[model samples]
Target: MSQSPHHKSFTARLRAHKIFGGIKPAVYKADALRSRVMPAPLPGNLVLPLLQHQGQPAMAVVEVGQAVLKYQVLAMGNGPLSVPVHAPTSGVITAIADSAVPGFGAQVQRCIHLQADGLDTAAELQPCLDYRALSHLQLLALIDAAGICGLGGAGFPTAEKLRVSIEQGVELLIINAAECEPYISADESLIRERADRVVSGAEILQSVCLAKRCVIAIEKDKADAIEALSTALQDSSIELLVLNSKFPTGGERQIIQAVTGFEVPRGLLPVDAGILVQNAGTAYAVHNAIVEGKPCISRITTLTGSPLQTPKNFEALIGTPVSFLFEMCGIDKSQHTGTIMGGSLMGIELDSDEVPLIKTTNCLLAKSTGEFPDPAPEQACIRCGYCADVCPARLLPQQLYAFSRSEDLDQLEEHGLADCIECGACAYVCPSHIPLVQYYRASKQAIAERDRQFQTSKQWQSRFQFHQYRLKKETTKALDKKLPGAEKTTANEPAQPFSRDQARDEIAAAVRRVAARHSNRTAPSSAKDKAKDKDRH
Candidate 1:
């Protein structure tokens, strides 16, 4: 029998598929999941963290004893890179301390404990319904006032992204619906349920960026989502593109390529190619920010895994504890030994369920022993190229593994270690079951630490050099001032044999030449011509 041509490649090996063992899909649910249009009653207590968005954490303006109302700015966003923190509900500020944050690497963050007043009283909001009359800057101020951020994993301030896009001349706004991760159904569910809101948000983004076109790209697997968005935006300029459901297709770079066929170069942003990509959830948030007076106080989270009694999406409050979520779902944490904040592919394991939800907590997975068995003990690498074949970033996993193992920072950098997205795709496919992503992360962290130290050293060196230069200039100036006829000195005289008057003449002449050149370039053409004619006469 003739062998098939496909048998020659990794596709054949992948087809074998013996490793995963046909694991059944698990259903996870959020008990209190609510729609943006619906008025979901606020949680009993809201723990609004100071650092909700990316960039510098917002500075807390309210004291512990102070009372605050809903939509009130409890903390002010710091710098151009951050967004303000708003009270999720009317409450008395209880305390500010290091608190647990879910899906985040850091166990402790600056958290504001709020005891909800339960009245949900309105806070004074600066209204700008007639946004058309406002300038772009005015629109941006409104967005900032609404405390909007990306809402996707990035959590970047929305206004900052818009400002950058406008300044850089963005042509296309790509709305990402490619929720390619295994268990993350937040974006999918949002688009299916709130197509109109998502479309409206995209329009707002379109207006802000002044983009020529808007494209909502969803995965082909999400047929219902594609249909919903397509129907909603059929008459509009927004185009819906169904992309292949590849893992990491939801990544900024990948989606940019999938939609516009433009690859953002390594270490560059999507805006560099005149493209701006925002998450579907982010678009929805933008819509709410513009039309309705709301900040990103809550988001849809998928609470899934076999351990849970019920599995469905929930619109979770930002500061709700993970334990509270599990309790709401009627899941007994005692029954499950392991819990992860994200999907099995890339989620981080939680030390405890006491962690409070943050902006990036997309899904919470509780795994019983039967559902998610612990990985087999890691073994030595046998030089098999399986890891490389599955790497979404197209990096040499084995080589990176080798460099990481040896702590060869130079070699790792040369091998493009920073490009690793830590997606665990390579580790998932490794025949040797090496934790390639973990090793890469360790290496990257070490490299980052070293770079930080280098930067600090460079900063100190720069300061030292600057101080030395200043001292030298001051000393020279003092010597020139003390010397006879020193003010007349110029560059023509040697420092040792300093002829003050002659040096002064040389300096004056050089200054005159520079001033004349500048004046000639900046002066009116007629004035320059007349001066030239007078010189000739």
Candidate 2:
């Protein structure tokens, strides 16, 4: 946590930047941040899903009933986008089967069920004390081995992002500490408690990406976190910028715009703008991976809402069930209505509490029966333009809603539905109480499915076309071999049709002539030659 004497403090004045069309929602995170991150009790059962990150799901390495230690690899990364899944604690693999996991929306994915033995045995770790001495690839390999990914968003592999950033020549690396979502302060809490670790992780990321400059962008409301980061970054080159606490400010594009005043072009990534943004918690995990030699098996999650007696953040394992957290937090079953993962605006309501936590899970809001009731009935759009005015991505929510209702994906794309952050800002400001974000979400899903089908169809079509081309090529080659003296024939003496019977007769005549010559030489010619030799003697 100490700063080097040679390092200079960043003297730039802290300035806040504005983003277009953002709403200021009630940040119900005070109670959650009241306590530090407490370690949750190890559950008897953990449901580790294979597809924890955003890529090809990890393939199971440990079979059923296999004993595994903490930090041991349970599943191996299947592709470049994937990160390995590690054992949260020493336990025996009970089963590997399809199970329900949070953020997967109703679909069951393959999960590794583990029965905790309570001993918490650990495997050997390869900690890098001096990451500066190692090459970027070495550091990234360590991160990959640690299974670190973006803990803030969709759980994109951190190694992959860093690799891409390095390839794109990143100029600025932005640490996203803006926990703008209401009732979710996991990032803020992390930065407040372990700002030094976050700073160190940012430095490692900067080193790996070879970024020219690095900055930590946080909300102005996170005063404690900012103070801690300022203290931690006293002798570092990394800059700290405080942004106004607004809804969706923590979004990648929004944070980018707020920090650098650059909007990511549609259909392009932030890296296209020479910028790389990572979540604050992801930075912390990087620090742990490089310095502490710990894999990303757990994360700090915010558990808050009216149903909990004592709401706070917990460093819960990845596969810990939400029901366990609810029980640990002393949930009032009589008043508990349901659990929503992430913030109220963008979170998905869980059908059952048995769903295990995944990498992207940041918040678990247990709503009371009356709290967070269903939205009002859908009303006709009055064209008041309120939804458009509050959109963070500057997308036409009204148009998107209409297109979504009619299943007009082309129009939706034309209006920039892909650019929509789904922050629920338009829905928050909607006059008709129409769930505009819901419509946009549905449209985005439809577009994704359509694109997937299109890509699959294109692949099949390409294969078919190649197959036809190959057949034509082979047929032409066979004909060339069959055609005799094809190139020798002139225009006036065009090649005649092939005749198998004529070729057979010609071959037979040639064989008969050879036999007649051989008979003449061996019979009467032999006697004449002998008489001539005797006369000469």
Candidate 3:
């Protein structure tokens, strides 16, 4: 039976649980949502980074000076955790060399530099007109070939996530349309412009995962988006879950809990909890891949900040440089203090404007000196418990901060440091201006490094034990050959490991045999000498 929008909305609200602990920050997304997503002009050059996704970097297939059409596979996914890289426009591969990774400071990774030609030629697409007729595996193959990933800033491969969802069996599929960040409105814009496509993509995902039910979770502030999605889903069974707009409400853990009234336990994923959450942008990409027969060559990114003359969303190609976007927006260079990728809480400040926008960039926020002034000097924690109150993961930020400062990894782990989402809620609420999230992030890295070192130590220990065993076995074999009357053991009899006392006994027995043999020879020589003397007489 098809559910009405009102019934589904009410049901979702009744079953929803309040997110553990979250803050409601001012949402600075009005300017970006003022206009529709504008198609960005093809740049003269594009720098496609290989390591845009989570896992291993993609391996380049095309060489320098090769002419490639749009949507051509330039680099293939190297490992299970990665997705392939596709050409955004028809261009010649000019160089494959190290380039600065966006958002990551001073880090360099391999990139495919392309010189775009005047013509934007595209390769032939193979769209599936009827996805229902195909098997689940076949649909997955198509999605993987298209190089789709979680466009929600995580960049997790979509096919890999769905494969796991299928294996584990998903009950609730949540399409996270909650753009709860302060300045980013990319997902909202995508849904507003292409809600039908997003719905179709959701249906396709439902079929793939065999989900029992699916829902699109959106915030109440996004009335236009909700209406668009509601109209598109009128004939569909997918539900619309309208939630209160709160900072970090769109977080995977928070959203899962909000929709299903179940919190994904610490140290486990949403799939472990029988829930699969995908970004609204990712679903749109899947629709393009399955129905339009298109590859993930471009995405909608929000370019908004106080330094720009006009802030708007752009449907940008994957490899366009940040400088070009700034130029298109008529951003004032003198007023621009820094460019941050993503939102204020979770976004990273890019060190250079030359950084190429990759698959995970949802927003590029150009800040002026007055807009995001330097944080006040960190003050001592007053222990007012405000940080703990705002932590959505229900973690005690005060304790975590102390443990982090002291490098008490065991204590941090016991207190649920791994579950900390680093949403910056604690820092935002801290009265002393302490950077609680920074401490938590550093502690997480320290824990990871410690774990890696411990694993290496275990490997060395295992190798040493094996080496010692080999030496002992060789020594035992040598003793067996040297010792006499040591009952020859048959192949079926396993060699008995010798104790220190047993080894001593074997050495003593060998000594006695040698002594006895010498005495017998001497006695025989004496007898021969006596017999010779008697014969002479």
Candidate 4:
């Protein structure tokens, strides 16, 4: 973690421009960083979820009992919004059923279960060392086929994002190495080992997006990672920026504002501000895809907590169960209920250790009862405005809190609730520990549901209107038909009338339909009554 001679001046330049409103909590990641990342052993069962990416769930291609090799496509999605799902190890598809896979927004989803045979086989891979020679569409297709997505917990499809940014003429690309969350060192450890790949990946992304400049934004406190990146980007034009370390500074909006001093307008994306932010791990994955001809099958995850024998990092494959890593560390988990997926502040607690790791799983914290106790019972908000003071989004969280509790979605949006990143900055600074993020999440979910219902109602209204229009057109055509030998019939002449039998049949059918409807409404599920009715008939 030696500093270059220019490190003093380089540090001062970034410090001169600082972001507003963030707290610096104690980062307990020293032990994890002390050791290099180790490859996690393949568990007995690997559960690959179909919907790992942001868009729709990829359709499963392999059926139960089918054999698959490492890096083979297990599922494929339709279009630009999704990436393919690949097998991590050579295995037989033992089951493909509804199941829980970790790293989603704290809920269970469908998964494809695989049983490894330990052979570690691979399918045929089309390696392209000359990505620069490929056309834009061809290159994007390659990235899509490789199943690449954002690893910074956003889980957005990388190819789709790059495609849109390129179309929109992105000006700046920012690579995030600012592992600002406490107890998370996956990105830092990855950079420490593979800084070259991260830089090269940034170059690829820059070319894909056609950005004017690429900058690697790291925290000033991470000296080792900074030094490593400095060496890697020395021969290149990419700039290494060292900013003050603070919670939520690693967020997309916050990082963009910190680096370029441009506040992304509310309800707009970072690309809307002429900037694109990507994670260091995502950059590394891109490099692996183009240069090494590898699909995204594994990610560097930080494994740390008090219950474990040692805290360290692991390059764990997707679908490795959380408890398997705990067992690998030889930990005593008797006192703990389950495990937390990410960091202490933003991570979700899982009641069962059976959850398997997916992309965006940066840490597996097996906290002891004493080390990671439950949040205290919610205390009443004191109306002290402390939450508003530390909000990085510059949002009035106090107002959002009241609107969310009251289920007032209209008021919530009017007061800028959507602008909140739920980065826990407000909750972190709350003196009453009100879990402000939870309230916002619930309110947003409610609003989304309401919007969905409204859209459905609109669709139904349109359908009804179309149906009425069709009926009117048919009725007019029938009325305007000329009668036989009446080519001289006047324009106001009456149309042909229904025959007597036709009218009788139509009335009888309507009567039968009404009678059937009434009978169904009054009928009870009794076999004896049905028999009695049949006998009476």
Candidate 5:
């Protein structure tokens, strides 16, 4: 929800979550938000990626050319970390193929292309007559079934997040309405039009959270949203905190520190700190899923930037192409060179406007000529410490930049590179114009690759250790095998684990396999060349 200083009485409580560090940049919301939100019909063919959320792509449940209804389950994912993908409207599945994803290049994701028949037919939905009547698990199951996720861009499955919060004994529920990013007002629009729904969703989440206190953390500049929510929660026990209008002030950790004066520890979630930060858009989505018995297939996306004749917010389908929004705004699709997702400071340039909207897509900015002029070539860092000063996570960007340049993971982690929110505060203030955020992104990806490999190896090592533990216990009994005539069908003998010597040998075999895999990847030279090198050596 948009936050403002309308509730002046709550200012004292708001001061508790003081602003930490952030940088201000040019905001382009005035022209963009001037035009109110309008519903954009789904494009000619909706291209829905099964991997809209933050886990494995949902497995397709329908075959090609099969007829489906609006809100019908196109794919299902029951994994703890995944959410299902649903059809946006009644259509036939035309193709399920790899397609280009927005914001990234050279990588293709599996997408379900649906050809709309204009039927607008919706599937039958089973609604919970009274949400209060359902148990917490039942509500979670409903949310999971609805494929609801963090609509504020993280795309983390909402059910899993709520379940984790409940499991971790989360105490405070901080509803994030910071909407601090410029030119992106989906949450603001939702709050302005449907603050009641947002509040109702918050109440439901609070019930599931079993939280002792609830806080709506929003920027004080959002006067309308603040007034709406102030009135909405007038008789409620929740606290309304109108925070400073700082860039990235709506960031998870920043808002957490701003509201509760608690800094989220590195490599840990906000829940670990006894807090659960959720987007206002997400809460509004939860309200829609449970109260309306609707599946998530559409969202409010800001289609702004200068390329279009008219820039405004559109309530578009989940898989509608960016070209559709451009056409809606009467802009030529070919001129979308700087089509970016999200706001200026943190937005990623789209390789093509054909990229379809996803649950996490909050904004689509197609810059017109000279809107975002090219930056000067990056110069060397001068150690001015300005990047450090503006860093919201308080990590040393210059140091991270140096380590990332050298591809040093140890120092990067030592300096807390993972904590950086990539809000571009450092890069914004840097005189060098260093793409520090990009470097950090690269570093994070690299570290993640290493962490994945390390985890696999650690699991094998754990298996080996467990085998050894069982082998020692096996010494007390002839657990490996019984003598031919001795103790037939003895039930008291302990169930033995894998043999330790065999386990050790298996581990050795695994090491060799891993080494061979790495060698095959890194050394693709011919056998002749290898022999020649060996002879030379």
Candidate 6:
């Protein structure tokens, strides 16, 4: 693909940045981020929540005190858009109520607290040994029924995307392996450990989505992962595309553009442009869901930073309490000043480590003052426009920042505020260290809520308008029937009549006239009473 002039200018600016100044080109390879240790199993007392995925929270099927085996569906998918929650370990549901989750802000969701029996007993698997025989829709339904979703951070229902693509016609499927965030190495570790499973998962996803071709987009940094995936799927129909090692390159739209040279139009989805992308980790989960009847119970997470005595990767069970994982990894909170989930750039800081791990928990970074330095207090924008220069979406971050700061919501929306991916690229490069992405997220949420309210009001107005129109039509028909020689009048009425607005105004005027006449008739009774009082006086 030919580089656009805009892209060329942006690249030149990026090269001048202090952060990229002395970065060795060899460090861009994927092996630099790969964890040296294999992932370890999580601890007991998994706090599995019902609402892990992006859609409607899965409805709880297992109640408190109920025994649930590993891989057993604890919560079932409520609709076509939802995915089910499963037991990470064989245990008794201790509690079924609200629990704290990291990175969720103020939203508390219903959680199933499981006290493990240490048995780790899994339910009987219904393996699809002959998955080749199953039709596309059949395979998709199985994936949905198993409650599988994108293990990638988005957590959108996998089956729903497939169904949508089947209807809309998806031409290409891009498997994202660009773990672009600074320290989140879960996807890289997964690729290193389960390359074949990841590829198999991609094939299953491709079949269900009915895409003509599948492209696995791995970062040039992860050469080992690229080689492993390429070797595993050498004879398969999947193509591995090595992408540039850049922060936020793993974003669905960015990866899609890098691989297919297609820019997904603003406010439109990948499927709208005949593209469906899934994370490499999500692909592995899909593979297990289809072939092994395994639900997404566990995922690999990177436990790294300077605070921990030893930093490594671990296969964490969904709902595993953050406190337990930290303890297991020898992470002493007393020694560390703060903890952040995901990565320092885009991740959220934890108020407390007691929060349970959700499906999207990819990394837990415990940092002291030196490892991850705190930014200076935010100041006024100097109009450097460095943010816009590095923004992958090619949006004006400074403009968005100004609109958001002023709370000019209309102007914000007009500026395509919703299109901001909140990738923290702007904040990452900003000299003033302004939390531009946070403001954008808050603005987007507010705008989305407003839009939802507007849509609801519109629907109500439409319904009311329809009903009023029907009532007026009926009233007119009744009035005509009641009039003298109504049948003759109807027969003589002209085919071409007044416009609806004119007719409505006339009806309103007539109603007001009739009201006036009624008031006039009642006026005499009050006069007679006044005359009687005057005579008595």
Best-performing candidate as measured by lDDT: 3
Candidate 3 per-residue lDDT over residues 1-537, each given as its tens digit: 122222244334434467878889888899999999999988999999988877778889999999999999999988778889999999899999998888443369989999999699999988889999999889998888889888999888999999998987777789999888999999999889899999999999988888878999999999889999999999999988898888788899999877876666678777876778999999989999999999999999999999998899999999999999999999999999999998888888888889898889999999998889999999998899988888999999999999999999999999999998788999998888898888988899889999999999999999999999999999999888864645544454787786999999999999999999788757757767778768989
- Choose 3 or 5, whichever is better by lDDT: 3
C-alpha lDDT values of all predictions: 0.75, 0.87, 0.88, 0.84, 0.83, 0.78
What are the RMSD figures for all models against the true structure? 14.8, 6.2, 8.1, 13.2, 17.5, 12.2
Which candidate would rank higher by TM-score, 3 or 6?
A: 3
Candidate 3 or 2, higher lDDT: 3
Query: Per model, how many backbone clashes are there?
Result: 13, 0, 0, 0, 2, 4
Q: Could you give candidate 6's per-residue lDDT for residues 162-266 as a string of tens digits?
A: 898899877778888888777777888788768999999999989888887788888777767777887898899888777667777778887766665656778
Record all residue pairs in model 2 with backbone atoms less than 3 Å apart, i.e. clashing: none
Q: List TM-scores for all candidates, in order.
A: 0.79, 0.86, 0.87, 0.86, 0.82, 0.80
| Residue 24 miss distance in model 6 (angstroms) | 11
The full ranking of all candidates by lDDT, starting with the best, is 3, 2, 4, 5, 6, 1
What does candidate 3 score on TM? 0.87
Error of 4 at 337 (Å): 3.1
Cα error of candidate 6 at position 453, Å: 3.8
Whole-model alpha-carbon lDDT for candidate 5: 0.83
- Model 2 off-target regions past 4 Å? 1-14, 104-106, 462-537
Model 6 regions more than 4 Å off: 1-39, 104-106, 455-537
lDDT of 3: 0.88
TM-score of 4: 0.86
Q: Can you give the lDDT of residue 134 in candidate 4?
A: 76
Candidate 1 global TM-score = 0.79
